[model samples]
Target: MNLLSKIDIRQLQVLKALLEKRNLSKVADQLGISQQAVSEQLKKLRHNFDDRLFIRTSNGVVPTPFAQSLQTKVTRALASIEDLLIAEEFDPKTISTTFTICSTDLEQTVILPKFLTLLRKHAPKVKLAVKTLSLDDIDSSLLTGKVDLVITNPMFAPNNYPSTTLYQEQYLCVASKDNQDIAVQSSISDVAKIPQLVVSPSRGEFSGAANKWFADQGHPRNVVLSVPTFTAAKACIAHSDLCGFIPARLLPDPTLKIISLDKQVPGFDVIAVWHQRSSQDKLHTYIRELLMQAASE
Candidate 1:
């Protein structure tokens, strides 16, 4: 048992590399050591394992049948250990991880304003990085470790990612308080003729309720402008008579009127998404809980 305890990790790594790359020089390069060192380690490994781990072939070293038999199990066991050691274990107030979040103009409008204030008050040390989900490659972005958190309307989930609804989203139109036409708001269709300000999160988002409303009704309203984000649309609507569709919560100004759409567009579900690596993380849970409570308010 004492002799078995003396067996080293370096010997295992060298043996695995020699079995994989086959050439002495290639394994030496992988281990960042000399070819002679690999030979020495290989000799030690053979004596300890009491097996001919590799056979010298005409071209390069080939693993013996016994070595091949142990390879798969050994590799998996080592990988499991590696994952356990490298996993993220977080503490919110003490954490200094810079978390990147992907959100739309709409999410930035509805969620971020309040969320940021909450963050500053509670977790000042935690850093937040914002990225617009500007492309359809959201899954790839998360999988490749590009983004940590995603806040999108109705957090629609894809395979390899889990989702939870952060909030319920309702849509309404915002027009300037002084705009005369807004005072006569009878129905959604009544304002169809108004110059519309629409937001497509991705440069050309044609799928939202605002974009589809006019065409579906066979009455194409005058679209004064098309912007990529709701924040931009909100700014445009603020200073002009152009009507913009926005979430119900964001219109905090008392001067602005809040009326739900008569036409039922699907309600948006705000969600937070991260890779499986972060799913069990404590800090992720803490931030998520805070956002969830904020949404409820």
Candidate 2:
């Protein structure tokens, strides 16, 4: 006999319902079938599994050890099949899963606070873990489930992952409050002459638009420091004469000054990305929408 052609999915579902409900009538009610229909399914299941499966008792029925052993596997298989056919609806207030995010300091500072506040109001039980976006293998991490989401510059996002751009942001030149050169609004050339701080999150020795801007105009910046994070660059600018360009949305300290560049420095799009596998996940899509809303605000 061909085992594949002999067993039926409906029979497996009936077995799962029997294990949970433990009575013919209750299983029929739960499955929207009649008690007679349920018995017919159980009869087929008995022939397929070659066991008594369930025994009649005064309390209704009891599972045989064979049936009991198959209960967990049968329930899991049905649940997996159901999930493939229908997306489980998400109610944020009741969800208790933790979501891991890969991001940069700028996004963590600017985006996470608002997202957390929203989550507290709605999804109080949901948790979040924010880690640095791996420069080497973020795509693999996302695809393999090491990370659930990524929030960063769209330019840096992996092409294979599905992404939504939240907002477009430009960089603003920031100088310490007491830094006289850029404090009073100097030319971009003069600003370049001052010690500059470069943000290179990937730790690559490459030039950004500002550097290229200076080079095209026949002068390159005197880059005094290169850091792997925006927070480090912020602290460096706040304490020393070094000046750096940071995302404009992250309003700088009231004491610090922002200077306009002579030539527009190209800006980047901020985006939220996730693996294609999670595209249909209700919670993932909900959080992605929340991020877009917060970024807009």
Candidate 3:
């Protein structure tokens, strides 16, 4: 039999424990094995290495000169083996990989500024890739690793994917402060009659969340313009007489004023979604945490 084949990992562990403790009883206690078992492993290690390894004294066993010479090499070998058995811990500072996120303009305006600040502060080396949220391509994008995360309203999230609600958002009926047609306090029927700007990011159709509310009240909205993003809608609404409903978080704008309605539009949840495969991913977990923090702030 080969000398290398005769040496087992258990025998090496025993050898290391014995070298550190210099006492069979102490090594057994530390290793959770019996003293006799410790001695048996030591005996096998001695035979395999062809060295007495330790000499018994009145106090305890002490390593021989030959064993002392093997100490550094054995420690290094054990460390390498441990590296093989243990998982490497995730470190944000050391990460240099890019993370891609698909987000609507609402999230880009309201959530990502603070998120980017936190991400840059902690993980300066990590690169971020932002893609415009497209309902048509989101499923395949997440499944194929083209997108790592999707931040959007819960209504727009891909079905069956795992998601965490970052925050709840309510809609605010906003119009240009210069617009004289709308008032600070107006009934839903009143606003429904005014020419509205509908933000249809996924589709160019003049439809929106407030449409259902208006229809439920027997007064369908008069949507005159359709824009692809909230940013675009905001810009258009500020200059034109097209009043629109935007998320409350995008308020306090100098050019826009909120239109208080008799009935409020239903609020929606903003969520972070990822592929099922990334349920246990450390980087995804960290990013989600950062997203929640950003939303809270």
Candidate 4:
């Protein structure tokens, strides 16, 4: 039989405690075990090592050369075990992780700049990668680690992912500063007479809810231009006679005039969505909070 095999980790721990305190009672107190228990562990340790590990002296006890030599290795091993058991608390400033977020052009222009600035002020080492979302590819993108989070309408979000609505986005009409039709007309029929710019992010199909709304009311829109993003729509509207709908949250430029449409275009719920794997992530949670704060502001 191997003597080392007979010795358990508890015996090693007791030996370490005994060496440090140089007293049996102190070792028991430190380990929260009975004095007899400590003595029994020490006896097993002594028998295994074939040494009088400690000897009583006038002060308390003196360690043998064997005990002194074993102390360093034992302390290091126990420290490592402790490290394995305790989880380190997260600190954002020291985090060097890169988060990839999926977003649309409107969100990139209106939301991300503020979010990035706030993130850098606290977690300077953390990095961000912004990618355009392909609604059809969301499942693979999230599962394969291509994107960490998505900022978009919850209606278009993947069902399996977790999401929180950051804010409600309402639509408002925008026209060029000199567009006479929009400036002079307050009725939906008169507004419909002017050419309209439409945002068709998926296929630039020149058709959506606005057209349907007009059609439902017996007057269809004459969509003269179709663009893929809000930025493009804004640029086209500012430079031409076309009028278009945009999110109310985005700040308008002086070259464009914002019009409150008489007809109601259903607003969307902008949500922050993430994969199931990141549901409990501390950093991801913090970033989500920051986004919510930015949206509220």
Candidate 5:
């Protein structure tokens, strides 16, 4: 197979639009190019792919099998490239744009509130579009331009995607006011043996690195019930005899104990990851940088 050159990206995009829109005039209108130009691009694309790419039908142009197979990947690759170009030319003050991001509920609940408030005060014109996606979905989404950023704690994709560490993923052992001695636990085993409350994202993603730590430490632990947020987890521990972890930044509650795991279990670092391709877009670049700054401080 021959390598796809940069010039081919535009041709593939035309094929993509043709495959989707079916009508030459409609495709041209959507692309803001003349119908003749669309036809010329399509002609070039058909020659390059050597596949009909699209076939005329009563309804409109229909993608051939080969074109159908190649459409998504080609579109995503082109989109990734587009993101890189746009990000390279970004200007935060003058340009107004929206960015889509995928993150854990914990990050959404805690960090996003702060980030939104900050952006509102400083960058009112900027907009954010947040969605929930499992860790498993991030890379494919990035490939397809589904989400601009993926935020995680203690780790990133195994693919070695570019990432910026925001802060330490903190964990503090906590108990109810009646059982404040939770912090005095000496070992992971000791902490584990304590009645524990579990908090997991909608995708079963744990808020932090505790699950991984448990697996690595060669320990099997017990979990009572899984809740949604740190606040909820805190509520469970406060009302019951259970103990669990919270972010270190959240100070100990008077009714609920908080103990930093600085000694027993290491804090996981926060990370914001994006495809290197994301750096090409002015919007992606500005938002990624702004989020990076938000994550760092």
Candidate 6:
């Protein structure tokens, strides 16, 4: 008889329980089976593997090197099976999980407020964890299950991963309402000459997305300051003589005013990206939909 023919899913379950509990009685209780049944399953498992998978001890049992090596593989297999079953019977209201999102200050300010409101209404029990976006760590973090979603410009998102464009965001040339030099309807050349504050979150350099636009108009931005976040840039621009481009959604501020340009500045698409492992996950799909809705609003 082939060894594969003798093995079954129940045997694998028994092996997993035993590996975790280490005691036959505990494994049996957890699985709602008798100790004799567990031992019988173990006996078959040992015979199939042709190894003494565990050794009897005063404490109950100890896994051999061979059995120890199987722990990760077995755990992963069981989790995958569980995910498969959950996908078929998923309900958003019943889910009680914490999802982590990686985002910049811009998304946190504009997207998260709406997304959180919808999330709370739809899945009250679901929690959220927000991590500041780190360009250097995004690839490894997504691959290692550190972040569930990334909300940012499509250009910054990981290449070839699953992503959906949430919305398009336009930039507004904003300056202090009190600034006498830069006024509304300021030309691009005029705005570029003023001491400009650039939001360069990922890098410390003074360059920004609007650099190419400025260069095309025969004017290079005189970036006098480089802040790491939009919040900081906004504060600095409001108090100082500095001006910079900010997302349009973050407007209506009492402290700053929008500087109408001679020509409209280009906008970029905001996108949500996730790991391929979550492509079939119901929760991820629903969350992506919520993001789109939130962006639209």
* Prediction 2 TM-score vs. true: 0.72
- Local accuracy of candidate 4 as per-residue lDDT tens digits, 1-297: 887689887988998888889988888889999999988988888888989999988877789998999999999988898899998898899999899998888788878888888899888999999987676777788889889899987756888789998888888878988877676335677677888988766666788547877888878878989887888888899899888888887746777898766677677888998899988899999999888887776
Off by over 4 Å in 1: 1-90, 113-124, 155-160, 205-207, 213-220, 254-266
Question: Against the unseen true structure, what C-alpha lDDT does each candidate score?
Answer: 0.74, 0.83, 0.89, 0.83, 0.72, 0.89
Candidate 6, overall lDDT? Answer: 0.89
Better of 1 and 6 by lDDT: 6
List the lowest-lDDT window of 10 residues for candidate 6: 81-90
Residue-wise C-alpha lDDT for candidate 2, range 263-288, written one tens digit per residue: 66678888888899999888898888
User: What would the per-residue lDDT of candidate 6 be over residues 1-297, giving only the tens digit for each residue?
Assistant: 887699887888999998999999999999999999999999999999998999999999999999999999888988887888773677788899999999999999998999999999999889999999887777888899999998878777789899998888899999999998887887888888899988876777687888888899799989989988889989999999999989888887899998998988788998888899999888989999899899899
Q: 201, model 6: CA deviation in Å?
A: 1.6
Q: Kindly list the per-residue Cα lDDT of model 3 for residues 127-213, writing each as its tens digit.
A: 999999997777899999999999887777777999999999999999999998789999998998999988877788777877887
Provide TM-scores for the models. Answer: 0.62, 0.72, 0.73, 0.70, 0.60, 0.73
Instruction: List ranges where model 6 is wrong by over 4 Å.
Output: 5-88
TM-score-best of 1 and 3? 3
Give the per-residue Cα lDDT of candidate 5 at 15. 77
Q: What is the lDDT of residue 16 in candidate 6?
A: 95
Tens-digit lDDT string for candidate 5 (174-243): 8787875565535776777776777665544433357667767876556767875666877888899887
What TM-score quantifies how close candidate 4 is to the native fold?
A: 0.70
Which parts of model 2 have CA positions greater than 4 angstroms off?
5-87, 202-206
lDDT of 2 at 205: 46
Alpha carbon deviation, residue 83, candidate 5 (Å): 19
Estimate candidate 1's alpha-carbon lDDT, on a 0 to 1 scale: 0.74
- lDDT, model 6, position 268: 93
